[model samples]
Target: MYTLHYDSPLGGILLAADEAGLTGLWFEGEKYFANILGPEQQERETPALQRTKRWLDVYFSGREPDFTPPLHPVGSPFRRAVWELLLQIPYGQTTTYGALAQQLAAKQGKTRMSAQAVGGAVGHNEISIIIPCHRVVGTSGSLTGYAGGIEKKVRLLQLEHVDMSRFFVPTKGTAI
Candidate 1:
């Protein structure tokens, strides 16, 4: 695994890649920091890393990026499915966990899928901003359960200029 560090408004972000493409990006001190790469990881700015940095630069400047870097996040089949759906979330929009579960259920031809299960998969996304796990909210429009911390999530939404009034930090649950 090859890694590089990017300085963003949020703080230092660690970017990792391999022969396939960009694999992981985690904020400093996030809950799953470097969860995908092993100790054999090396620090090198590959083309993928450079592209990811440029993408971050545009995104942090409050402009929607025109392209997405090649992403090759490592995860189970279920997590991959959830992450793929996360990527479809528009730049300044948010969706509920229950809504995502319903979509996944429809895709899988099942009657129902649990919102909690979708939340677990969303929480485990290896690529943060690029895959857009932060766009997932609770059914009640509560900002909840971001592995990178809710403060960063809020800032990311603000960066995208998402309407803050539509979402709230839950008073009695994991949002705190």
Candidate 2:
């Protein structure tokens, strides 16, 4: 295991990578990552990890980045689908967790997705803003569970130019 930390508007996030690719982006990294690393782990240079940080910088600046690097995502199939779908969420939009689950479910001819399940998956995303999980909101337009924190979610959405007026509107058709 190899690791390093970088600053983000959300705080310092720790990144880890192996030969497989960059594996995780952990918020409030120093304590979180330190606990998980095995003693044999060393700090190694990862161009992929570095590139991910650079892309995060672009995202914080409100410009979507073109991330073509290898991402070693660890999750169940449904979770992977949710994370990939997050990528399709154009930079300046928000979608409700139910809406996202419904959208994903439509691919398989069903309209059932548990907000709890999707929320759990989103919470564990190894990649954050670059993948845009921050775009997912409560069905009521409430900023809900974000591993990075709801305030960070608000900041990210604000940076993406999502109007503040929609911040807490929970109409039935409200997006994520």
Task: Kindly report which residue stretches of model 2 are placed more than 4 angstroms away from their true locations once superposed.
Answer: 29-40, 169-176
RMSD list, candidates in order: 1.1, 4.4
Residues 1-176, model 1: lDDT tens digits: 89999999899999999978899999999998898788898899888898999999999999999999889989999999999999999999999999999999999999999999999999999999999999988887889989888999999999989999978877665733
Query: Poorest 10 consecutive residues of model 1 by lDDT?
Result: 167-176
**Model 1: pairs clashing at backbone N, Cα or C within 3 Å:** none
Q: Pick the candidate with the highest lDDT.
A: 1
In model 1, where do residues sit more than 4 Å from their true spots?
A: none
